[model samples]
Target: MNKTKNNFIYNIITKDLKKCKHKKIYTRFPPEPNGYLHIGHAKSILLNFNIAKKFNGICNLRLDDTNPSKENKKYVNSIKYDIKWLGFKFYYDIYYTSQYFYLLYKFSIKLIKNGLAYIDELNKHQISKYKGNFNNLGKNSPYRKRSINENLIFFKKMKNGFFNNGKISLRAKINMLSPNILMRDPILYRIKFNKHYKTKYIWCIYPMYDFAHCLSDYIEKITHSLCTLEFQDNKILYDWFLNNLKIFNKPKQYEFSRLNIEYNVISKRKLSILIKKKIITGWDDPRIVTLSGLRNRGYTSNSILNFCNSIGVTRQNSLIKISFLENFIRKELNIKSQRLIAVLNPIKIIIENFNKIKEKILIPNHPQNKNMGKRKYVFSKEIYIDNKDFKEKKTNGYRGLTIGNKVKLRYSYIIKAKKIKKDKNGNIIYILCKYYKNRKKNNVNGIIHWISKLYSIPAIFFLYYNLFKISNPENKKNFIKYINKKSLVINRGFIEKNIKNINNFSYQFERKGYFCLNKNFKNNNIFYFNRIVKLKNII
Candidate 1:
């Protein structure tokens, strides 16, 4: 286990252990199965599971599948996959809030029989108006004075599907004038006719998140319910549900700042809109920050975990620069990824003075690690280099190929530019060069990567940029308007032939950025590679 830094939550857990507040600690990651997990979800997963591992406790994976209207089995499976992909194992069988529907319904009944709850006939808009804002106190509903027997009969009718969807809602008869708006008669149960993925139509009325969350925690015996800072206000209602029920061993709620990366949106609603409008391919689009998307873009689980740990746990919300997350993967791939030569903007280079048709050259897979071994490539009479690496008219300090200067081809002999050929439009189509035979170092302008025309493999490269043009797209009234049109740029390229057998590993494409085989790659004639990150951090 990696050593976790002692944060405020860690200190609290330690004190609880020392004081024997509980024999063991329990933590859970409860996610609504409405969409794919994002990087923000990763922070919670690591914190909960890591805390369990640190103190010899247990962490459970609980699916808050209370909202059947948007929940499904596919998202549940995805949530499980993401957690496991992040290298975490839940304590035992996965738990679902739907599993405790009976208990939760009975708990609501207990509240109603004790005269602590009542039924409200207010519509959605009316509920909002009565809830009031922070500036003004809310007014109690007309039904708040309903007799206990009347409330129970109406609640039973709601459970029996006698009430149409949104006709009537069972609410906790808390304070309507309370300062905390959430506590001002929050909805306990609502009628939803949508079929649940797990329970199907057996449940017409489902418990609200606030009602099911704390009760589910108590039933599961969760000791510490860790959540994001946005729930700091909801903590009051979270406790209210547990406290009113008078349940022993009630889990305490703790909040930490959620991971918010600039230029990204983790909100499920916004993400769904992006998909609906085809702003992105899907949740796994390489430009997205969703866990599946990051994994598809060649991010390793270790790099993500390290990034989460580096940020640590805190209560204050702040926007993290996207480079901070990119740096972790960049550093990890630097040591682990193999080096391969590729030319995205191919400009042909013909070595006129070369004696042999082709010769073999060996290049180390990694510069600093000899044990990573080397791969052989064909240095032929004709080769291709990136167009950006040459200049017809040399500027000051130009290090690439020019009329009078020599440049070194990586893992090959030095070559000097002698002449160039142009197309009908006066564009340089290719360059003619003469190669030196001696394996001796020469004063070359710069070293450049190339692939032999005879041995080069045709491939397509997908270069991804930030999906949003601005740092914070959510600030705009219409975030979609700020979507970067050039987020994905495709380039036809050539990679070394040897890369065919090494599809599983990420590679640094020599001077180009790090890349990995696209998850959708299948054709042998043309390979597809996705650019993971740049060779270095670029603003």
Candidate 2:
């Protein structure tokens, strides 16, 4: 509503409204509640909800809980939490596909009475053989010729739990030779004895996804039933059900390509395996892009919405570089987060001339925003600097600490390294330095941040890399083989003591990157922070 964007779907809705095709715009986000919502799902949510907002209409949150075996209450609650966290609200009370089970049963009965559907005696494999592939013409089932009354009796038996799972299925009487495979006598109902979380054992024969989807939209009066491109072929069947049922005010569906990100697989099945095998921590592991994962990793809702908008809605399938998302997250956090110092690989620096007294240093929490105010950190004789900031021997044009090298202690003093202390092994244990307060005279090379060794608090830092080594891990025969063993590397680090008082906001660790606390921690007084994203200019 702020400013119209150039998206084909939005343009279509605008045309529809102008032509009075719809008195008001209405859309719905239909998730199955089988798993956590991923970044791909986020795209759909934004598209539907934003389209409704743009036209001054409404959007509904509908749970398509057709297969109760995979669905559960936890998934339902998590889906709701993710939607609200993304800054969108449902227009009405939450609706479930289970709510229309009885209505769906009646429609199927009408199909049977109209001779448009029948109960198939063919087994699962036999049906597949009859419903031929692209190269072959399909043959109708032997039972396809059964009378409507007989089919109705069998279907009633199916509902009464007389048939075991996969014993019988109800199929629409579409063309057996239809070139479009989905329209070739697709199944309308299947026997599943699994107890539904919502409906319980009230019904054993549940309607198939294709049959329930269109009818649910029709029942709720959704004007636009947006879906992904994989369902384009199924659109034929989506319409067939509505038309055959003789329903009024039918909903129209439009297909757009689902979002794909490189180096990550968004499939729920693969993600479930990753969780079941304990490969990654959980669904909210920061390495993956599930909405809860992004939230736990400190990604802002506005950043995700902006990323979806920047990608633009289109029908052509494409793979977006993961950096496209990281760039937006970094851009948002740069303005919203305050700057703080943290040393991952610490090495001690002793100011030889400075006395062992702690002095307060005041620095702005945000560089450009004065309203964020300043925080006071104590600086003492001894401080911890990043191990990478120094070398026992200087490299060509190196600006960091080495023998006789002078560098500014960021926002503090220009100091020259005098000597280094080593243990039995040839590793530096500490560095000796002398401060030159007369900064005008000394040619300081560069500035590096540090934390007071005395006043700093110890915290665990999680440096996460890509979970999979291959860009398309899901395509591999064995995806677990491509899992990166070093995906999560833990390091004990130090942060400014005042960080303990910081709330649920992102903080930049100077030269390192932006980081935030892993909200899942439960240990007593032991804190852990996850690296949200490294500092890089992607734009």
Best TM-score among the predictions, by candidate number: 1
Q: Write the per-residue lDDT of candidate 1 for residues 1-539, one digit (tens) a residue.
A: 24355478998999899999989989999999999999999999998998899899999999999999999999999999999999988779999999999999999999999999999999989999999999999998988999999999999999998989889999998898999999899999999999999999899999999889988888888899999888889988987887788887889999889888999888999999999999899989889999999999999999999998888888888899999999999999998888888899899999998878899877888899999898888999899999888998889987888987888888778999999999999988789999997646578898888899999989999999999999988667799989999999999989888887675578888778899989787896998999999877432
Shift in Å, residue 142, candidate 2: 3.1
Global lDDT of model 2: 0.88
TM-score of each: 0.95, 0.93
Which lDDT tens digits does candidate 2 get at residues 216-273?
A: 9999899999999999988889888888888878899999988988778788999999
Deviation from native of the Cα of residue 225 in model 2, angstroms: 1.1
Error of 1 at 510 (Å): 0.6
- Span of 10 residues, lowest total lDDT, candidate 2: 1-10
In candidate 1, stretches whose alpha carbon ends up further than 4 angstroms from where it belongs are 1-5, 438-443, 474-477, 537-539
